[model samples]
Target: MRLGPDTLGTLPAEIAQCGYDRAGQAIGVVHFGIGAFHRAHQAWYLDRAMAAGERDWAISALTLRSPTVAEQLGPQDGLYSLTERAGAGERTRVIGAVREVLFARPDAERAIERVAAPECRIVSFTVTEKGYCRAESGGLDLERAQESFYPVLSAALAQRAARGQAGVTLLSCDNLAGNGAVLHGLVREWLAAHSPDTLAWFEANCTSPSTMVDRIVPRTTEADLQALEERLGLEDRGAVFTERFSQWVIEDDFAARRPRWEELGVQMVADVAPYEAAKLRMLNGAHSLLAYCGLRAGHTYVHEAAGDPALRQLAERLMVDEAMPTLDPAPGQDLAAYARDLLTRFADPALRHRLDQIAMDGTQKIPQRWLDTAAWHCARGQAPGAIREAFDAWCWHLADARFVDDPEAKRLVRAASGGGRQTLLDACFGGGAGAPLWPEYAHLRPLFEGRRGGS
Candidate 1:
């Protein structure tokens, strides 16, 4: 059993010694939401940068939701495992890129200090789409009190305003359209309430650079833990495993020093809008569809769902026909290659991506996943059959039903369904379900008022 850092590996104290050689403190980026994905992806990229002797980019990992991660990681000298799983088996690698870790559980006061740290030049986030505390109009919503919700950027800018420190770039690596603008609005709202002067500093000196991060980080199960324990002969309480594929794209705009992240496979571009839209509409949207409909179709896990001949073809066709044509071309992205790679990653049996895990928060997720594209197609006089199928599946799944794994979403689902498809469509879309949309979407109303997952 791994009792401490001695059993896991050497403590990461060396990385924080300001050992950037020439760059002094090196890159001081504060990354929020310390989850398994950020550990395997962003932290790995920083490790690669450090190994290549590209000093100056060290990360301060911050957790806003859970305190367990902070407790476990802080003592082990900020130690964790990044096990890479592929077709063959699992390979274990220790990640030590995080020089420090902080918690924002109870409040944002201290968390804001870390983000506003003078040495902390770039503040990045893996806080996901819902964390920005934004409303439908893409402005800050003060009453964001959900589990995943937090006023992170808002508080950070307030700290900057009070300290007279400005000009720190805000980077959002979540999956959202124009994530920068989303974050910018959240920060601006906090500024308007707390410090309007600071908002000016942010606008003049800082920039919210939009970014898109893609990877398949499945839940690390007990089976994965057992496999890693045997392979390394070391027990890690926080060991996380993932399929072997990753990607990151950033719209290059920064106020202070940042890592040459492009040095290690990260693509820097003029704008990430097209790419973000493509991934959001196709990749993430499809993931949601498969998580619900695929499971109802009798598939157990994400791998099982992808391996299904019918479901696999459904995914490919949805991407090729319904999803791809809706978005413009990315600079260096090969749509065909990207789609193929996503399938391979999703199909990895060992990863065992949980169906319910993706299914949770459907109330918050479906707007972006299935509804947005469906509404767009409706306006263009086109029918979004595949997406509607997904919407219907989601509405059905929300009935405290066993479509995936969300009790909370299941409770809220009745608000959409229970009555009829038109009623559900009315609830999900409101006045803007599009003009021609309700008619095409009404085709599925009968199903919603009926039982779900009969097949």
Candidate 2:
């Protein structure tokens, strides 16, 4: 039978089912994105918190554009299975934290109403890096902002202010550097332009805390669905497959009462900057290196790439030598141990994380993941070798026929084709004058020329 409320009691004894009563659970969070990563990471944490007796923290998940997730979870009553894979071991659990799923397009009014509700204390987002409609200047692109969640959220906040209700926390769970501050800036910019009257109330009432979320949630395959069916005796279409390890470091600045997430292995801290920097520079930076260099080396999956001695060495060097030095880690946080743990996580044999998946939106990711680290070294009169190699690999990947997923694909392709090395560098780094590593780029010209000639 298909997994739903009714099938919960009939699942196999070994499969962990939700122990909490869903009927008594109240919707307190209105999440913007109901994607797989959110399901495996944030939703999983909230599920654990609920299972531990926090009943009012259930989620009303919103899908802004795609209706697939809403459809998948709606039929199941927001009931789905989470499979944590580590080597030969795996565990499946039904998560009931997502109480409702709404498609934001048709259900925009309903979603706004839900957010405006007094019970909704947190409005979280997992809308990816590009979803924020951020411009190159690190501010909200007013033109693009119109199509984002800003309008919907602004309307909701305006409603709440009009009713004199308490404000909600805005939590951004994307992988961008300073995600919370970026989100707040975007919201404020949007509000200032469109609804100037509401800006004061929002600034006074709301809190947007930065967060660093880490988990390797790959795209689920049909084999995974089949395994779930055979093992648990239920077919769950909205299932997610992720690695066993997960980490969430949140800034402790919520506007309203929140789930006791710290009790469930989440790190609640005063400043999430150090944690965020480490994650962006080390974990995500290494992933980008692996994705570009690994694909060029003919590896499809992250594990295969990580298992390669040369690629592994490059990854470790990038993390330990280049990225780690750029971070000011929190007290008691061991950078070396964290680097070692990351290598192990990347080598997980059970996670078939596609390099192409990580390769998508390279233009949006590379600045924080690599360029900033390289620039940091450049400022200190040190050239990071691994980053240079990774940057060259990225250029090659952009030129390849297989790469066409980035939002800036056409521009990058033009740069790769027309101006050769320097032009491409200028295009990516915003010209020689403004480029952070202009001098370094000049020094690397010979290397770029040789690689281009070989290709």
Candidate 1: 10-residue stretch with minimal lDDT:
14-23
Candidate 2 residue-wise lDDT, 1-455, digit = tens: 88999878899888887799888988999999889999999999999998988878899999987999988898899999999999999998999999999998898999999999999999999998889997766778889877779888999999998899998999999998888888988999998998888889999999999999999999988988997889988889999999989999999999999999889899999999999999999999999999999988999999999999999999999999999999998899999999999999999989999999999998788878987887788778888888888887888887673855887887777666665766677665444544432343344344334444212
Query: What are the runs in model 2 whose C-alpha is more than 4 Å off?
Result: 417-419, 431-455
User: Which residue pairs come into collision in candidate 2?
Assistant: none
> Each model's C-alpha lDDT?
0.69, 0.87
Worst 10 residues of 2 by lDDT: 446-455
Residue pairs in candidate 1 whose N, alpha carbon or C atoms collide under 3 angstroms: 26-56, 27-56, 27-57, 356-404, 356-405, 421-445
- How much RMSD separates candidate 2 from the native structure? 2.6
TM accuracy, model 1: 0.86
Candidate 2 residue 447 Cα shift, in angstroms, is 9.5
What is the alpha-carbon lDDT for the whole of candidate 1?
A: 0.69
Best by lDDT: 2
What lDDT score is found at residue 193 in candidate 2? 91
Q: Each prediction's Cα RMSD?
A: 4.7, 2.6
Q: Residue 297 of candidate 2: its Cα lDDT? A: 91
